[model samples]
Target: MIGAATFFDGYTVIAIAYAMPVLAKEWSLTPGQIGLILSAGYLGQLFGALFFGWLAERIGRMKVLTFTILLFVAMDVACLFASGAVAMMAFRFIQGIGTGGEVPVASAYVNELIGSKKRGRFFLLYEVMFLLGLVGAGIIGYFLVPVYGWKVMFAVGLVPAALLIPLRFFLFESPRWLASKGRVEEADRIVSRLEQSVIKSGKTLAPVVEMPMAARPNAAQGWRELFKGMYFKRSLVIWAMWFGSYMVANGLITWLPTLYRQHFHLPLETSLAYGFMTSAAGVVAAVICALLIDKVGRRRWYIGALFCAAIPLGLLAATGATTPLQILMMAGLGYAMLQTVTFSLYLYSAELFPTRLRALGTGIGSAWLRLGSAMGPLVVGVAISGAGVHYVFGTFAIVLLITGCITALFAIETKGRVLEELSP
Candidate 1:
């Protein structure tokens, strides 16, 4: 249910990209203005991730996840009443902040609950639903926005907001979190529940390792450990990786609908459908990566997807304002591969650092992610304005190429490694 809650949140935001054209007309927005609106959410995401990441490292992941989701509920509802572009932008930015924190913290929390052998499968299942949220968002915009207007599109956020409160009632503390916090008895209690749930779910588990008495978190050291010594290098690499991927993802996603309509001379409805279909491909890759990550190995997966992605984005750049199908197929591959790499990192970022700064470490990476998201659209928008849309796609191809090379150069493989075994 927590996973279901997150899926809906992801679905809503990505779908909004598809709805931009209608909103732009109804609200009278320009390309540069729309870019700002798209970028604002990520600006908020940066702050939200940093603060909440630190909070999770200190106060605990589950509690912070609940609070953040509830905040998401409130901000999403506020979006329904937004009357102008500025107000709508403000609401979306705040809504994005909530989502930014909710997702990474939740990923760390849930992955910690499940055991190592099945962790890949558990996250895969969770992300599959997350992608479904994208499909649902696209579909909702496709049908409802034509009749009900964009406000109704936002009103639908209520459904997930309602679902979150009840689902959280049954939530438990993360055992890894408890174990790290010196609450071994509590850790055992949660781990037993996890063992039971996995068994009842009919998933196989590895032999359990009894908690060592000495590995618990020391309160005095705090999250500052993330920036000290060896931890700093890992943190920098993860941050660079996340920043690059997010730059590509947001740069494309936020402006994509408008790009389609303008470049291909297509109707709004067709653009929405195209967004839905391609993002669905991304859904497939994300789920597959999550499912196979433990089996395939992270370093190999990251390098392969980055290289594969660069090819399509280059092709997309070469397509140069062709038919909708051409644009969709070319750009869709980039989107899907981007998502594959992105989802793989959800676990990777958290896995890279030691237990003490797991959230902070991931948060540090996500901070750059939001920065990328914030800047990507703005930069791409300028590229389109100064040159042509072809130049923008070509530029993105270069970015992807750089991203792939960097991934090959820097990332460490962490397949099948124990969570606490990761060092600072």
Candidate 2:
């Protein structure tokens, strides 16, 4: 259910990127205006991550997830009615709150459910739905945008509202969250129910092993705790990872369609097709990461991914991003490399803190994600207007290089380590 919700979240978030080409032509939007419209959603996402992350830690994940889904769905409908840049920006900003809030909290919730064995693979496989959602938006945009128009992008986003029913009625709150709150009995009840369901399928259960109790910090201290103790360094590292990866990844993904159409004079179909291909490449890279990250280890995988991405981006800048095919092939590869880092950071972030802080910490860390996401498009706008498109790739390559160095020096490996053991 969470995966399904995120699928729509992915679709709705990137759908605007697909719509931008037509909207730009129709509205005669300046590059700056286009950046503002794109940035608005991500800016809204920053607040949403903070507010909703804090709320989930208090009220529980399921309820907050429900509210977020409803919020974005309604705003998506509102987007269908938007007639200009200002109106679209306003609607997307409001809608971003919902999409932004859902992922990190959902990441925390899902992470808490599984054991250490194959945890990287399991969580990342779930994370792939969001990437698929990006591809879905691109596919929809490729076929539908030219015929049915931009409004159709917003219209298809409405489908996730139906997910609310299953979310509310069928899902239980995170048991690890309950246990952290000292509601041991309630947590045990939910766990027992899961165990019983597994036994009913004729699988024998392993004997329970006692694990070290994770520190339950005062939940009320909230965001302040992130800056104290072991978490302080962890927080900084993850935040840097989130910001650097997202800034480059989203900058490329969101602006590529419009850039192709406006800058290269490609037909609408070709532009959307190129964008979709980039997204598809990212999905493939992400799946490969999902399959192998556990053995490679988190710290090494991230450091390698970051450095690998820098190579293509740096080359693109050195060579000058002159041709459409050149931009697509080089930038697409760079985006795919960063995509692995961006998609898996939630798993890494949640592992960095205890349950008491997991959702909140992930939320706050992802706020940097929102900031980077917002900045990426704006930077692209400024770079294109001033230094030319090649300089955009040059800037991203520098960011990736710095981030890769930081990860190499400081990041800790979390693969196959139990959450409680890793953080505590």
Candidate 3:
């Protein structure tokens, strides 16, 4: 149910990207203007991630999650009524707030429920739905945009509002968050219910190991706690990872269809098809990464994936994107690997903090993601307008190089280590 809810965030985000070709034509938009439309939700996401993440820490994750779902869905429906680029931008920004808040808070919730031994694969399987949502939007656009028009796409996004009613009834508050807030009895009740559900599945339950009470938080933690002492290094490194990864990932994924349609002048369907193919390839790569991440280790996988993703972009930049097969193969493969980096960052970021600040830390890191996501398309637009397409990919190559080196040099290994032991 959590994964299913997160699907809407990915669905709405990429749906707008896919709609760009039609929207640009309809509004007579400049490249900069189109980039703004592509990025508007991310801008809303920056504020949303910060505010909702902080709020979730105080009020509880489920309440904020419910509210954000309604907010984004309402904005999505409002998008169906947009008159022009300005109104569309307004709607997208507000919609972005809900989508943005959902993922990081959900990450904290999921991470709190799992043992460190299983977190990478478990959380990432959930994360893959977000990628699948991207592909779902592609599938929807390939068939719908050329027939029913872009408005139909926004209409499809409105379906998540129905998800809210069911979520309120079914979703439990994060036990870790509850514990952190001194609601130990409530936390224990939820955890006991989960254990009972698992036992009902005919599986033997493992004995619970209690953490020392001193290690467990009793007071609510504030965002300011993220930058003090042990957490400060983690806060910086995770922010860098989020910014660098999303800048390249969102820049490529969001702009690929538009780039194909406008620069190459491919038929509309072909461009959407190509975008869909890249997104599908990314999902495949992310799944593979999720499967192997525990064994490969987070720091090693990040270092390797970042450099592997960079090489293709470097080649694309150097040779120019004239050779279609080469561009498709190299760019597709690179972006696929980066998708691994993009999705796994949630897992990595969540592990970096203790339970009390987990949501806030993840939210703040994701805010940088929102910043990079917002910048990626705008950067592409400016680079295309002035320096050309090669420069945009080249910039990505450099950014990836920096982030990869930072990971190789600075990032600590987290695989197989319990979160309480590591963070405490």
User: Who wins the lDDT comparison?
Assistant: 2
Q: Is candidate 2 or candidate 3 better by TM-score?
A: 2
TM-score of 2: 0.98
lDDT of 1: 0.77
Encode model 2's per-residue lDDT on 1-424: one tens digit a residue.
8899989989988999999999999999999999999999999999999999999999999888999899999999999999899999999999999888998899999999988889999999999999999999999999999999899999999988775556578899999899877799999999999999999999988888688665566657878989998899999999999999999999999999999999999999999999999999999999999999999999999999999999999999999989999999999999998999999999999999988889999999999999999999999999999889999999999999999999999999998887878777
Off by over 4 Å in 3: 215-221, 323-325
State candidate 1's TM-score.
Answer: 0.93
lDDT of 1 at 214: 44
Evaluated against the true structure, the overall lDDT of model 3 is: 0.89
lDDT of 1 by residue, 207-312 (tens): 7676444444456766666666667677777887898888887687668777777656678888777877877788888877877777888888888887788787
RMSD of 3: 1.5
Q: All candidates' TM-scores?
A: 0.93, 0.98, 0.97
